[model samples]
Every structure is written in structure tokens, then in C-alpha cells.
Target: MNERVNGLSETAVKLDRAGLDGMDRAPPQLDRLEREFQTFMREVDEAAAQLRLKAKPIWFGPVKADIDAESALLKDERRKDPPQQEADAKIIQPERLDPSQENGKFAAGSLKSMDADTGPVRAQPQPSGAPKMGEAEKAEGGSSDVFHRRLGPINLADNLQAGIRAVRRNLLVVMGFTLATNVLVLAIPVYLFQISDRVLTSRSTDTLVMLTILIAGAVILNAVLDAIRRFILMRTAVEVAAQLGAPILGAAARASLHSNGREYQTLGDLQQLRSFLVSGTLLSFLDAPLTPLFMLAVFLVHPDLGYIAVVAALLLLVIAFINQKMTASAFHEAGNFQSRANLHLDSMSRNSQIINALAMIPEAVKIWGQDTAGSLKAQVLAQDRNVISASVSKAVRMLAQVAMLGWGAYLSLEGQLTGGMVIAASIIAGRALAPVEGAIEGWHQFIHTRSAYERISVLLKSSPLNFERLKLPRPQGRLDVERLLFVPQGTKRVVLNGVSFTLAAGESLAVIGDSGAGKTTLGKMLVGSLLPTSGNVRLDLMDLRNWDQRQFGENIGYLPQDVQLFPGTIKANIGRMRDDASDEDIYKAARLADVHELISTFAQGYETMVAADGSPLSGGQKQRIALARAFFGNPRLVVLDEPNSNLDGSGDAALLRALSHAKREKITVITITQRPSLLNCVDKILLLSNGTVAMFGVREEVLKALAPLNATNGRPAVASQTPQVA
Candidate 1:
């Protein structure tokens, strides 16, 4: 055996060297042979190790028998005094005798597992210096417990702040450009001074040409710098949007699941914020700080010109303040009205078919017109105030320029200032007040952007991003709902109260209830779409909240009552929009839902386009396609609410076949329905009435129980119950 092992090792080394030397030249057969030889060598090594373990001394049997008997006796004693003896018991077994040794001597390491009827070994105390488990987990990231992974609610405000920090470098570059551009702008006034004092007095055409060329070059450079600053700001805005876009959309999607009739204006607010970033308003803010520098230039010309510039700036500032005070409330009110108008418009667009079919367009328009009129009225008021303030600010600025020129003229006549000084001071004074005037003009936009920022901040705080959850193994569809209770937000009515049920893997349950009897709510709770106000929903002994949402979603399938497909190819919709879904999986899902042949009848087949608003296809077709989507990816659990609501006879037969297929595949299913035909395909029935369980048992037993109730009431048990739950 040893000789064979040595020979194999030598052969492996020779093969390795040969493979490296002739890797490119080696034939496919040679590579295959090499792999086979390596696998054989591994098997030989394992077999040899097992043989060595089995090889023992002939005289070791008696000693092993004695140890086995002793072990058996110790086990018996432990059974008699189970708790105390099991805690304190430690058994010693004789070590395997070395095959080469004639004398039976134990190895040195054998004492570690042995104890001679000693009392329970006291656990070794942890060293004072060592951190406890909880402390270690905290150092890593709070507790390892599912409910307390973080120290407190996630600080989503920091997430928004972090996006700004990510673009800090670009902002700094913009600021540098702003400074350089402002300094270069001084060239115009300086050129005016030189042309008036030097060129005109000297009558030197050469000096005139030089000053024009120099000032033109400075103007061009300033334009180039300004363009670069704007480009940088635009890119920074895009980058910030990209950084926060996914997280914001994810939060909105989660918020939609929990709330009803709550409009999510986060995306629009983000767009407003981004537009403000790249707008001229931001540049005006940057230039406002350099206004004092321009004022200082005017001061260098003459103190009286400086004083005029200061007064103009002060007056403009006061006008801006008045504009803000007057228009702030109006703009805010306009924004609120505009949001409502947008919501109404979106609803009308989504239900355009219904409006057209019912000929309700006139009434819809009138309703939306009211909201639009309110928004327009508030906006018109705000704009009126803004225009008035801007006109006053403009008058103050032009008056200041006129005052500077007139005063300079008087000073020049009195021989107190030069003609060049008069012209330069007038130009410099206008530059000094340009920022304040521009700011006044853009004041309304500034107010809107500030309002958007505040709204976005509040939205983020209310709907924090989901925390990273630990990935758990795929569940086997063993569902246990224990005393579930749910009450809708901002309402006193209970939708589901003390609803409890259990379903094992492969079982099919029919959840039948009257309209508004909480069947849909129960289905949502089972699929993890809606959280229970109390009690637990466990899958495979693990709480639903403990599983990562993405992973949990991948394992469970859901089809809501209103079947809506995303705007995409039929193949994509059936594949649940997953880019990675294979052709085989798509075909299998369609076949399982009995939709494959129906889809094939279309001209484009699976490649046919579909819209969220049902188009081209009939209501039954949409329901069938949605059913296929639910069965896609072979989900372990499938929840279908009103699965057969739009199904015809043929579609109903297909659904029955699908349910049977699900049972055969051991995929647990919870079907919410009012139709009695589906109950025949299910293994069990759960009847709900007035947000409580009316009856729950095996199919025959439940039907038998309901049979007497039906007879007494002269109607079906479910249909007889009144709608009480929301």
C-alpha cells in the first residue's frame, strides 16, 4: 500500500510539471486523463486512511469490551438521575491500541475527555479583561436579536446628509470657480477707468487696442469659468439624485404597502431639490457673498460712491425681506393645492377607461378643475407680490446708479474727482448691487425649493429605509398564524381580529368569506404584505419579520384582487420582471397556470406587450397572466386573493388544474375566494365572518358543518354573513 501511495505521488508530480510545460500543446484527452488521475489519487488516500483506522491489535478486544460495558452502566445511571447525573456525568473510554505496539498503552491525549466520577466541572470564569458576548455584538452593531439589531430607529436624515457629503468635492470646485469668475469680472470697470483716464487724454490708439484686447480676454475666461461651474453643479445634482434615488423609491414602495390614500410626493420633491441645485438661483447665492468686494472697489474710487452703493444694497435687502414675508404663505398654500391636484390627475389617468366607458369625463374634469383653480389662485397671488417687490427693487437699483453718476458729475465739475473716476464708480456700484437684485427676482423659487426640502426631510423621517436583515434558509411552507389582529391606521375598525390557522407543507387552504369579511386582509398578512397588529406569523418556525424581505418575497407568491401587470412584454410580466428568469422557468409557469396555449394563440405570442391598464387582452386574460406570475419561480407559498373573480368556465377549469398541480408539487397555497367551485380543489376550508373565524377544519368536515347552517338559513353560510370588517 505504501509503495502504491509513493508511486501515485511521484506520478502526480510528473503530471503537474508536464501540464505546466505543455498546457497550450496538451490535447483534450490528456487533460481529461489528468483530472481522472487526480480524483483517483484522492480516493486512494481516503481509503488508505480508513484502513489504518480499522487496523487494531488482536488483544485489544477485552479492554474495549470492558470500556463499552462501563459506558453502558454510566448511561443507565444518568437515565435514573437524569437531570443531576446528566449534568455531572463524565465517562472515560479506553483509547485505541496502536497496531505496532505489543503492550496496550494509552496515548497521552486520552485524559482530556475523561473524568473519574467528579462533581460537575464548574465552568471556567471568563477573564475580567475579556468582553461579554452582548458587548461584542454591540461593538459590531447593536444586538444580534432580530428585533434589536440597531440601537434605535434608523437615522435616514443622515442618509440624505451623506449624499450631500458625497458631492462636497464638486461643490468646493464650484465655489473656487465662483471666486475666480468674480475677480475676473473686475476687468470691465478697470478697463473703463483706463480708457477714460489714459487712452482719451493721451490719444494713444496703441493703448486703447491693448486695453480692449486684455478686457476681452478676461471676459472670455470668465465666461468659460462660469460655464464650467454650471457644468459641475449639474453633474453634482445628478450624482446626488442617483445616490438617493434607489433608497427613496424603496422606502416609497414599502410605505405604499402599509398606508392607503396617502400620497407619496417624495420623487417630485427630490426633482425640485435637484432643479434648484442646477438653477441660476444657486449661482446668485454664491455671488451674493462677493457683493461686498465690488462695493469696496467703488469705495476705492470715492467714499460718497461707496455710501450710495451701500444704501442701494440695504434697500434691495429690505425689499427681498418684504417679498418673502408676503409670498411665503401663498406659495406654501399653492404647493399643497398643487399636490392634491396632481393626486386627482393621477387617479383620473389610471381610471381613464372607466371614465370613458361611463361618460363621466365632464364631471371628472369639473372635480379636478376645482383643485387646479385653487392652486392657480394661490400661485397668482404669490407671483403678483413677487413682481411688485422685484419692480421696487429694480427702481431702487437704477436710482442708485443714477445717483452715483450724477454725484460723480458734480464732483468732477468741482475738481474733486476725475472723469474716469466717475465712469468707473458708476459701473462698480451696479456690479455691487447686481446679486441683491437677482436674488430678489429668484426669491419665489428659493421659497419653493426650501418647502420641497422640508417636505422631503419629513417624508424620510416618517418612512425610514429598511435595515439590512440576515438571510435565512428557504422555508418549506409550514405556515402558522397565531391569534393575528389587525386594525387599519387612523381607524377604529378591526379588519382581522384573533384569526388563527396553520397549514403544513403541500396543503391547500381555501379562505372563503363574504365581501369585506377580511379574506383579502388575511391573505395579505399571510404573504407578509401587511403586518399583524398583534400575534405572530411564522414560516418554518421562524418569524416572517426575521427573514430578509427580498429573500422572503422570492419564496412567496402573491396575486392581489385587482390584477395589474406592469408595462412590459408578456414574457417579462409572467417572469415577474426578473431579468435572470430562464426560458424554461417562464414556460413552466405558463404551462402550470394553463396559460401557455392561450398565450401562443397571440400573433407575438409571449413577446406581446401588455400595459398596467388592461389593453388588447380581456379581463380573463389578465387574471390568467397574473396567475402565471404567481406560479413563476416555483414559489414555496402562493397566496391568491379572489383568484377566480374574472374567470369564465374554461379559465375556471384551468385554475382547478393549477391548484391540483400545486398540491402535487407540495407548494402550499392559500386561496381567498367567494366562489364555491374552488373549495372542491382545496384540502381544508377556513370560513371567516365579521373579522373572526366562523369555521376551520378539513374540507369535508367544514362543508358538513356549514351544510346544516346553510339549511337552517336557506342560503350559503358565507353569503348569509353581513359585511362588518373593512
Candidate 2:
């Protein structure tokens, strides 16, 4: 190996020395390119490092060395870990509208978390089996129950009734104005026909002057009434829209948990229905309805020709019916395509950042483009049918008018119909056919609009969170879990099996566990966010199943893991309801949560609007605000899930101080967390294992049982107290 290397170096040196070789070192451009490539690689590595990955270890009992690999998404439920099996059932929809989960978190660094303003909404445990607070704690500070409004059923006649009322009032006020304009409009041709028959026949100027005045008056009259009609029509549309929007969302909010909790589809259908109301009545009114009114006014003046006009309308209707029936299926399909394409575009917009980041731009664009193209293609076909339909209808209308004109002329020549009558009849016949043309346009729009309304309605009627057979009085905050069976609400996984514990008023319990320990699930059940499949969460002497809905909501305050902040003034967000809260009270809560300083620094201070979950603030700042919102109600019990996850040391210290304050106030604080600092402040700890109580009792006593496993490589004898795990 050394001789061969020496020969290659020697050959290169000899060749260079002989001046046969061009260079001895790499080029400057190559060095620059190499440096640039390295920089790019560094960036890619940093970006890749930020990706989130969930993993679980598999250990063959007492096995020596464990192999590391990516954790697989749980498949074949029968073989999955119990926790994973439970989670699988809880997922709302595997095929969801939002595709962000397919890859992971937002590709645009970190997404700002959304915190819903719970405001005065308390999530007290249900009476069915949810734990309750004692009388002492309840008397100290109690929250208000959730208010549900009654939403009546939708009757088909409701809309038409509204329309009839509006139109009648409008017509009463405008009909006289319309009549004056109509008479003026009719007088022009009538005067001309009379002049040709009388004045021109007799060479007179009286009718000529009258004809001039009538045409000018007709224009003036229309200009005035048309303005009023336009405003009234617009007002009518607004009234209709307002009436439909209100009862929907409010009704959905009031629906019984058991009745429509599964009908999430109802809300989407209702939205579609409202859209139909907008396009069907308002747009079509101007497009087609006016034509019929004009036709009707003319027919009233000329019966001799109106009969011929009526015949023409019948022919037109026959043609229109044939055309509509033949193309109805295609138009319906087009409407559906447009709706789907619109939804597709919305999905694309939300995931644009991820698609662009991973060079999946073309794929995303392709999906959107396909839908758009299909929609456009359907529209073009529908447009063709419409045009053909319109042409056929128009031809028949013109034929009827021409035939009427000929019949009128023949009658006048025979002295059966007068000359003025012939002219008036012809005009009247054309006007009568106007409404038929309007129907075609109105019918199409009505279908699409109705479709939209139906979709929106479905969305509005979606089922609320279910809490069946839970009708007991509110708890007083005494929670008992006696040999309770743990059943995952979404999935059938057993997080806690035969677990037993008791939470008394004025006591704080800190539950510390690793991820997948079912800590969050238990917290949710306690706070009414979720219901247990089989376990009994008893309150005082009774089960939560028997609790009253309204009263239960007032007793407990819950802070979920994902905080949702509403977009509004800080004061509005924090105080929410109970606007009666004093400025000092809000500031105290803010200061406790450590968000007072952060919010006060904004331009508007507490009045400042928080856009998109307080984008102006950092994660810790937003979290502080959420914490403040949670404690605003001063309920009997507070259940917090990972409240300190994003807080810095300072923020965390402030949070602990606030929790200490809550304890001092004699509030029952149940915390789900993994933070060690929480262990020091809690009155006791509950250790959960395999959906069962691994350990429970005072913090000092329970910690002794977990000490053996918590011991380091060089620690003294650790465990002292041990509570047996079932």
C-alpha cells in the first residue's frame, strides 16, 4: 500500500515539475462552491433536527441490550399497546378535512397555538358519575352554569311568510308609484297609435303634443320609482339574511347533547342553505321577476293581442320544460362540482406552507387544479345548455309575437279590432312572455342556493358533546374513586383498571406521569371534557350521573392542554362574561398569571386586540394570558393540564405562586403534569400504572415507594413507604 501511494505522488510531482500539468491545488471557484454546499447542508440538518417524533420502547423481559428504531404508528389494534389503542378511538376522524397531520406540525417553524376563550364557561363534572365539590368549597366561590337557549323547529312556510310580509308592505307603498310610471310608459305607444289612426289620419297637432309629454313623463316617473324599489328590494334581502343566520348557530348551541351530538354534518348543510337564500331570491329577483311584471302590465291594456301573447307563452313553456328536464342532471352535477372545488381550494390554502416547504407544491397545485378544471368543465357544459334553452325560448316568444301582430292587423283591416287596439295588444303580448324567461334563470339559482342552505343547516345541527343520563344535582366537590374501572371514551384501551382514590375539599392532588400514562384522560374526565366508559366518578354521597347540567357547569374550572384564546381585547378575553368584574380584579388575575406586564406593554394595554391567539406575544406570554383566563371565574375546583409546559423559570415560579394562592383560598386544585416542582407543593400524589392505582396517599409517603426506581447510579437506600399496585 505504501509503495503504490508513493508511486502515484512521485508521478504527479514529476509530471508537474516537467511543466506538463496545469496546476497543483484545487481551483478557488471549487473551494467557494464546496463552502457554499457545506453551509446548505448545515441549514438542512438544523431544520431536520426540529422534526417531532413519538417513540415507544419494546423490552423482552430482562433482555440485555435494547435496539433503537422509529416507533410505528399503532396498527392491528389487537397487538397495540393499551394506551395507543385508547388514543385511536378518540381521534375525531381519520380522514379529516385538514391534512396537516399527514406530515406533522406546521413546516413554518412553530405554529402559534390557539386558545379558546372559555370565558365564564365552567366544565363541572356531570352528575352521572363525575366527582363533586363539598358545601364548604362551593360556598366560598361558585361558578355559573352554562345557559342553553331554546331553538324552535324550521317550518317550510316560515320563509315564504317572511317574504309575503315584506313584499306586501313594499308593494302597498310602491304600487301607486309603479302604476303612474306604468301608465306613462303605456301612454307613449298608445298616443302614437292614436295619432296615426286619428291625428295623422286627420292631420291634427293635439295628439302629437300629448304624445311628447307622455314619453317625457314616463321616463321621469320610472327614474323616481325605480330608485325606491331598488332600496326596498335591498332592504328585503337584508331582512331575510338576518332572520336565517340567528336561529341556526344559537339553535345548535341549545341542542340536547343526546339528540344531535353526532350530527356534525348538519352545520355544514345549514351554511349551504343560507347561501341558497342569498342567490336564489335576491339575484334572481332582479334577473327574472321584473320581466314578468312588465309583461303583465302590458297584457292588462290589450286583450285582443293578449290572447295571442298567452298562446306564445304556452309554446315557450313547453320548450323550456323540455330543455330543463334534459339538462337538469348536468346542472346539478355542476353545482356539486363547484361546491367541492371550493372546499378543495380552502384545504389547499391552509396547507400551503407545508406543501411549499417540502417541495410538494406541484402535488398540492395538481390537486387544486384538478378540482378547478372539473368544476370549470361542468360549468361550460351547463352554460351551453342554458344558452340553448334561452335561444329556444326566445325564438318561440318572438314567433308568438309575430303571429299575434299578423292576427291583430288582419282583424283591424276587417274592422273587428281597432288600429290603437292592435298596437297596444302587440306590446302587451311581448310583456306577458317576460315572466317565463325569468323562471328559467330563477329555477337554476334556486337549486344551487337551496343546496348551499341545506349544507349549512347540517353543519349547524351537529351533535354536541354527549353526557347522557347525567341529570343529578351539582356536586359539592367531594370526589370518590373506589375501585373504579377505567375505560377510554374514544378507544377501548384501559388506562386505569380498578383504580381507587378520594379527593376531599380544600385538598390539592398533583398527578405526575410520563406521556401515555393516561394523565390527560383522567384530568379530562374530572373536568367534564370527557366521560368515562364504565367508571363511576362519585361526588359527595351520590354519583355524577345524577348531577344537574346547569348547576354542574358552575362548580369546576378546567384548562385544557391546548389553550384557545379568542381574538379580542385582553380585558374582554380575560373577563369574558361577568363583565361586572372590577379592573382591579382582572389585574390581580393577570398579575397572578404573570401576563399583566406583557399585555400592559402593548399599544392599547388591556384593551389591545389579540389577533390569531395573541401573535404579538411569545408562547409563554400567551400561556400566561390563558392561565389568567382560567382562574377568572374563581370556581370551587380548578383542573389544569400541563399549564406550565411553555413557561420559563420566572413564569413557572409565578404560576406556582398562583397555585399556592389558590390553595390558600381553600380551592380544590387537581393538576395533571410531569413537572417536578409541582411535587413539592401538592398535598399528596397518585401514581397510576396499567390503568390501575400503583400508589396513593400523602406526597412524602408515596414518593418513598417510587424512590427505588428514581434512585441514581450512586444514591443511598431510597424507598421507605410502599402502597401496593393492584
Candidate 3:
């Protein structure tokens, strides 16, 4: 081993010293070998250059010594512990090599290359203790927390915070004006004191006139501030309502389709909150906080007066607490009953025709009466509690006034107080307790507002679909459903499972199913009206949830199982109730649905008025109008669910012609139906049963497959020209 190591070292040293010089001095064969070696060396140098291997100077002698020393160290370590082996028992130091220089150079070079590729190092994740930037901003800046929160996930505190933020500006104005108004109130008592002490005693006409003018000026100032404050609060309430009106209605409308609670209650909650904002009850609340200031003024009058005022204030507070404790639960129950009754009434009114026709009015009335009676009983109980507390509070207030008067007279007789001071002290003491008395009187209203706030809070917690998303250009009507599943809320039954399909642009497909087979639900999902529980429904390769709903709605048309027509003129209904819908667009849609001639039969033509739910218009007329509206704007994708349910022969023919025209225009159509007539126009068929696909293929193939089943059931198959599947 030592001889081999020495020989390698000698070879390396000889080559380094004499290789270039000896190349020319050698024989031809030796020269050829040396040149070939140099060529191979050059190739290696080029390969190393490509690999970015930088060469550093090193000595062979030190490397040899280090290897020998490392081997000796390992042997010694192994001999000391034969059971275990250590690969790095001792660090070998190369005396001729600078370890720091080589390691530092290589590390620095590698780091420079990586830094260029990856940029700067990223910071570590934030600690749990760190507050979110949005939360920090909300705390520092006065922004509505409710506005930030959605309707279903938030609590009452967040709602109150939002309400406070909404009226924050007006509240500041009101507080300042309230202070001014109450301060001006001081002018009245001061004037009374001066009148009795100075004007009455001295009999100075000029002083009396000056004092009267100053007091009148203060009264005018107080009235002006009060009016301004009231106006600001009123406007603020209107502004808040205006801002929240859309969100509240949006929530209620969405909730009505799914949520069990009274959907209309949200509207009432908004009304109650706005009324509270503008009501005298709110003003009294503002004044209640100034009760302490009035008591302090009374204290300045006399210690006896101050003590009486404190006792009166404390008594009113206790009475106020009793009033809330007694009436709150009753008020809450009454409100619940009232909302429930209202919901039942709304449902009844919408179905009044059926109720009256079936002679169900008596039974309906009995149920409504029960609800109303329950609500009335709760209201009466709450009022009774309120009246009792109010009577007791009034009695206590009267006794406090009488006691103050007696104390004042005694002090006056004892020569410790003047007549004017006695009068002033009594007045101030009453003023101190007045706000609390007012609050007790308005306790019922306060409770109602509190209830309204709570309901509104819950309504505001429901999060709407986020409309802020990447805007894509209009879709090409290419629909894709991938492994879709839907389970309705609060139900264990699945409506759809693993439903996967793709529909190309400009293709027509008919969805046919037995009753309760999720046909309507499928149509709704396709049109982006309802979301899938799992997987995805996409249009033009983009998820429908990510699409801007309003923008998507403009390009997509849907006629639901139950057709709805807004209260409007025939022209407006055909034009989708859009104010900006042109006459040409309206005429085109009406013509497309073949409703123009039927509409023309009316004396007023397009100007014919339609009642709510398209009342007074026949069912066929409403369905035709809805169909026209669905085709309005020439939507790229159209979904029709049971479109011909109420249509007559002429209406049916019109619907068929409309479908043909839509196909001609390359509109992708998905129609949910049970009729063979509509099936004749569709190119493909999808038959669903028990929430799974029974058969899906070209209309011909699906109809052919079902032929055998129909024959076995003793039912004739649909004519091949008008193929159908059941």
C-alpha cells in the first residue's frame, strides 16, 4: 500500500514538472501518446467547464499523508471497540490545504447561483398571536362589522357593531346637540331662580327684560339644535336602510327557498330598526345618559337637594330594570308569534284562489285565529307588565318631588336656603329623574328594537355568493358536469350522485324522468341557478360558481317548472322586465315564442297590464309570456322545465317552432319534460330515475332501448318519428 501510494505521488509530480517539455523530446510513438493524453485532458476540461466545476490548486503529498493518517485513526478506533465501527473517528487535517478557503469558495458560488434563480428567502409564517390586517383595520377604523360579515355566520354583537358604525357620524352630531339642548335647559331654571330672587325682590324692569331675552335666545338655540339633530338621525336611518335594503332582500329571497323561518320577517326587522332610529325612544336614551349632569347641578343647589335627586335617580333605575325584566320575555314571544302568523298569512294569500275554490277558508281562518290570539295574549301580558312598572315608577317620582318640596321648605325656614334656591333645587331634582321616567315609558319600544336588531343580525349572517371574481368573456354554451352530487340541506336522501356528462355548444338535449326524479333540479344546476353539493358544473371550462352571476344570467335563460311573470305590461314581461329592453328586442322575443298574434288579440296589444303572478292572464298566456322572456336577449343556453304544462295546442305549436328557431340559432337547449311532442325536437335524451341515470344517448338509441320495456308493460311505444322514453 505504501509503495503504490508513493508511486502515484511520483507519477503526478513527474507529469506536472516534465509533461510539456518531454512531449517534443520524446520518440514519435511517445509524442503521439502524449498528444492524445493532452487531447483527452482538454476534453475533460471542457466537460468540467460545462458542469461548472471550478478547479482549485492542491498538493498530492498532503492528500497522501491525510489518507494514511485517516486509515491509522480508524484502525485504532476499531481495535478499541471491536463491536462498533466509526467512519469518522478522527478528523484528518491536510496541512497543505486551506479547508476554509475551499469550502467558503464553493458555498459562496453555489449560493450566488441559487439566489439568481429563486430570488430572496421568504419570511416564516406569522405567529398565532399576530392579528390579521383586516381585523386590525376594523378595530382602528370605524367600519361596519356586519357589512363585512355574511348573514348566517355572524352573531348579534357583530350586527350591533355594524349598526353603530352605520350611524356613527350621526351619533356624534346627536350627542353634541343633546348636550347643547340640555345645557340650554339649565337657562330655564337659572332664569326662574333670578326671576324669584333678583327681579321679584329688586323690582328691576331692565334686568327682567334682559333675562327674558337671554332665556328666549337659549330656548331658540336649543330648538334649532334639537331639530338639526333629529333631521340628521332621520336621514341617517334612511341611509342605513338604503344601504342594507338590497343585502337584506337578497338574503330573504334566498332564504325563502330553503330556510324555515319567516322570510318576510327580515323586512319587518329592517322597519323596526329604522323606526327605533327615528323614534322619540332613541332621543330619550340619549337624554338618559345626561341624567348624571342634571343631578350634579342639583348637588350644587344644596346637599339635601343632591341627596333627594340621587335617591330619585336610583329608584327610577330600579324601576327601569324591573320593567325590562318583566316585559322582555313576553315581548320576545309576541314577536315570534307575530312573525309566524304573518308568514302563514302570506302563504294563505298567495294560495287564496285554491283555498276559496276548495271551501278551505273556514279551516284556514281557524288556524290564523289561533296564531293571532296567541300573539295578542303575549302582547297583552307584556303591556300589563309595562303598565304596572310605569304606575309604580310614576308614584315613586311623585313622592320624590313631594319629599324635595318639603325638604326645601324646611331649609328655607331654617335660614339655610332662599325661596328661589328652594324652587330651583326641586326643579333640578325632577329634571334629573325625567330621562329615566321617559325610558321606562318607552321600554316596550326598546324591547321591540332589541328583538329587531337580533333578527336582523341573524339575517345579515347569511353569506351571499361572492360576485367578485375573475371576469371571463361570454361562454360558448359548452356545459360540463363532472362527478356531480347534490344532497338537499337537512335531508339524508341524495338527489343526484356521480352524475357526469358533457353537452357541446349548440346541441339540444331533453331530460325526461318520472315524478320526483330530480329533473327540475338538474335543469336548475345546468343553468347555474343551483350549485352542486360535490364535484363541479362548468360552462366553457369555467366553474359556474366563479362566474359573475348577473353577467351569466344575461346570457342564460331558464323557465322554471312554476312559471313566474312580474306585474308589468305585456311588452315589459316579454322584455324580461328590463327598463332598457328595446322595442325591437321585445317584438323579436314575442315573435320567437309565437305569442305576438295572441297578444295582438288584446285591444291594447303590447300595452296590456298583467297583475301580480300574471293574474287575470290565463295560465297558457303566462306560460307563453315566460317562454318569450326565456328566449329574450337570445340567450346562449336555455333551460326549460315543463314548459308546455299549461299550453294549449296553438301554444304547444308555438313552443315547438321556438325550439326549432333556437336550434337554428345554435342555442344550446336543455328541456326537462314528460311529453313526446317536445321530445321530437330534441337530438339527445337523458332519462333519470331514483336520482341516477336510467339511460342517456342519442334520442333514437334511448327510445329503441325502451321499446322492449314498453311492449312488455302492454304500452305502445312512441312513434319513431316522435321517439319517447319513460
Residue-wise C-alpha lDDT for candidate 1, range 1-726, written one tens digit per residue:
576567657766666788766666556646666686677788886775444444321121112234664467447545645774443232222332232322653344422231333221122343222112333222322222122123222445556776679668787888899999999988988998898899999999999999999999999999999999999999888987876666566566768797543436778878988998899988888899899999998888889989999999999999999999999999999988888888888889889999999999999999889989999999999999999999999899999999999999999999989998898888888887888888998999999988877776666667644544544434557787889999988899998999988777668998887888899998988888889899889876577886656667767789899989999999999988977777887898898788998999999999999977868789899999999999887778999999989999999999999999887776899999887778888888899998999889988778777766765766644422221111
In candidate 3, stretches whose alpha carbon ends up further than 4 angstroms from where it belongs are 1-163, 723-725
> In model 2, which regions exceed 4 Å deviation?
1-195, 202-204, 208-226, 246-308, 318-367, 410-415, 418-420, 456-502, 510-556, 577-581, 597-609, 683-726
Which one wins on lDDT? 1
Cα-based lDDT at residue 511, candidate 2: 80
Model 1 — which ten-residue stretch has the worst lDDT?
56-65
Model 3, CA-based lDDT: 0.75
Write candidate 3's Cα lDDT for 200-241 as tens digits.
Answer: 999999999999999999999999999999999999898778
Screening candidate 1 with a backbone cut-off below 3 angstroms (N, C-alpha, C), the clashing residue pairs are none
Better of 1 and 3 by TM-score: 1
How far out, in Å, is residue 45 in model 1? 7.2
- Order by TM-score, highest first: 1, 3, 2
How much lDDT does each candidate structure score?
0.78, 0.59, 0.75
User: TM-score: which is higher, 1 or 2?
Assistant: 1
| TM-scores for every candidate against the unseen true structure | 0.79, 0.61, 0.77
